[model samples]
Target: MSSGIALARLMFVVLGLVFIATASLRARPQSDVLIMRNGDRLTCEIKRLERGVLYASFDYVDGTVSINWAKVARVESRQLFIVQAEDGSVYEGALRTEEAPGKAPVRIEVLHPAQPARVFEQGRVVELHQTAESFWKRVSGNFDSGLIYTKGNDTTQYNLGVGLRLRRERWNGEVGFNSTLSKTAGVSASTRNESWVQAERLVGRKRWFYAGAARFLESAQQGINLQTTLGGGAGRYVKDSNSARFSVLAGLAYQKTQYEPASGSQNPPNAMAGLFAGNLQLFRFKKTALELSASALPVLTEAGRVRTYVNSSYSIQIVANLWFKISFYGNWDNRPPATFSGSDYGTSSNVSWTFH
Candidate 1:
């Protein structure tokens, strides 16, 4: 036992050292210098600036750090970057900073261009993604977990969620998971599991052709044991910028489902339905990002049944790599299997960690 303990401690030390040596975002073979307002300088790789934060990765013990973009006094780097301004101007060049005397606003200079250095205010520059980052560094997402317990009702619930998004030159892909399990003494355990994957190819700049698959398994009042669906659709982005995005999607879906009636009466335990589905999604990036999505599916046949779901959440950055999210979900089935309500809704809050 003592030998085993000693080996575990040695392994832990090795892992700690590895973590301290490597940063979350891989660095290219160039050193980027960043000057802070307090006259501090860091020889780190400037990863990207998004949502009012500048991310830097260094080969030191601190790994990666997020700096308020406004706190950066100046930066000098020869690496190419994709810079986007709030007024929709884009530049592909290296960046240098100019601080004029007195209270004049600092200006960002676009280098290597034939024209004289184009200068802009700090806040006007909304996005900067380094071209030196590898393909994988362009991907981003987050994971969330939630829990709820009721003493009087003797019930406890748990939730787990994860999402990943990847954007290539002209293509984008997203994968997401949302799962929940609930337990109560002297009663059946309830579980809801959902997973979805979507792929999109950009048409022009703001439009996309997309296809996806979804699998769902749910229990409790709604009473669906399994559901598998395939869908294809087109989408349009009304507003697409670094700080926020708004999009709409319309699609056709084919689904097969198996369910036990909520009232325990046999009302066709299986179903095959063709549906017209659509959704509207909005995302904002800030210290507190607000996300909203709503979807609806109407049965093609004369069954006159419809399914609608709405989700809204606010995510607040709490600390390094962590966020607190308060979310609400509502699902409706116009026509349930048998003797079930037409609605299911819940509100929850979670602390989520993010990695890119």
Candidate 2:
């Protein structure tokens, strides 16, 4: 068989195995209970708690429903979970709420099978996720795509983005891919592609982390056939709350570039650089979300040369697990190969779907 065919078959087999494993892990009794501050009660399977929203699934509901975490007064669940507190403390166990008297503050309880139960005030708990034996059960991701065509100019543009995240008790992993293509009747096609994988581990319990990442990029506008980067650094969260998060990192990176032959490059192919980056996220419950990230790399081996990247996205929830998103990306290099552009930037609008 051709190598392409064999690769496709292998991918299918791997995906099938993952599906089976996830299905088995998700086969749990829908016996979890929630009590609301206004005395409303629900019996459903809890999915996760993120950004001040609690997600749950009911047998009669067509799709998952989101609840305001602040409005919840009590919870009971038998399934295991990994929970994070506002102070960055991590816990693993089943969940319950302590029964309190009228007008008293609610307290959450984490019940471990072997260890003593841990309790915290409801307001102190920040995040929660159901845990299972299968790795697939700890994975979440989203996909986005956009296309635009203009008949008068015979112009067409396409965009695609995919992201995956794996969450563990004290570590996390992420993978991302993005591509853009543009074609016009009488103009050369423009294309750009980017992919990256990153892993992060929590340090001492104060929102500090260490991370490592590898990134690859190709840009027609910049005359880059490919550029690769490997970097590692330590970072800390400047702000961590239900509504927003901000973090900054500083580290070192090594990068190599392969320029298009047409550019007649004279610069060196490799460089060592200092990396500085920051990321911010803001959420408005199920209504809207915003993300911004920026990175700057100052070349150590090549004097007076620096590279930068900026990305921003805004998403509005359209319905359950679906959103309308607008995104902007910009890449810049202070110095470049002869006759090549020093910067590339673009904007896109997409429909996105997320799953866990």
Candidate 3:
């Protein structure tokens, strides 16, 4: 066979794999079905509802269940959308537009721009949605898992994640779980688990630009000592780097950590704060691109009296599906008193394995 013909066949094989993967990622169980407004019932799993489109998963024998949000007068669901807190707690109720003031730390009420704005002298009211308990049941078990390894230090880590999204017409509210484990020599093997969720509004003609993500992170670290933190970040992206538009993002996070030695109770909470440096990427070349970013998180206590450190990272993409990343990390422990000797740096390179 000619080299040209062989190359064509290879491309076809890759493309076929890609399509199969996409289909699998989107496929759902046959039992999923949703009924829309106008008394019309459909047989499909709702993929996602964004803008006016209600994406669904349907099978031949199961029938079709798809509905547009605008056309949806009301939803008939054996399931609904609900929000779960980072504490592994679940809240079951209906979405409401008005929440009583000065009652809860997180006040959730449905967003209303048309409702006359009113100021409460008592407290603040945050918009939130109300849904049924079963909503959480239907969307359960959609989780992801993976493992990552570092060759230089022979370090390996595993991760598990669960994600959820709440759709309004053009906007979505999301939340989920993220947990990880790492093992290496010299460094005490550790595991960190974080649960976070975010909300973003779709903007632009094609809804390609995800305005931003308001994410929360609640994590615990285990090793010789156990430590935990509650933190979060907000991120946004600009679409179409080839154009004049350069997307930039800024974020801030705070964490309270307590360390408990195996034999004793937890230590007092220490403050950890992070600041968004910046990110810029230009995708001009078909197979090449340039991206730069820097973010720093520092232990926010007095340098000498309190254990402190700053973690930072930077990365650049050299070729299609390939990139290099560098991370700088440091930490201090005050218990030993004035022992400032501690810092580390690491780098990683990733290559794409595009089976699809």
Could you say which candidate leads in lDDT?
Answer: 2
Provide the overall lDDT of each model, using Cα atoms, as 2-decimal numbers. 0.67, 0.87, 0.37
Please list the residue runs of candidate 2 whose C-alpha ends up more than 4 Å from where it truly belongs after superposition: 1-27
Q: Estimate each model's TM-score.
A: 0.71, 0.92, 0.35
> How does candidate 2 score on lDDT?
0.87
User: Model 1 — which ten-residue stretch has the worst lDDT?
Assistant: 2-11
Q: How many clashes in each candidate?
A: 0, 0, 10
> Which 10 successive residues of model 3 have the least lDDT summed?
119-128
- TM-score order of candidates, top first: 2, 1, 3
Candidate 1: the clashing residue pairs are none
lDDT of 3 by residue, 90-162 (tens): 2223222233354333233322344432221111211113332333322312234456787899988765444
Ranking by lDDT: 2, 1, 3
Model 3 TM-score, 2 decimals: 0.35
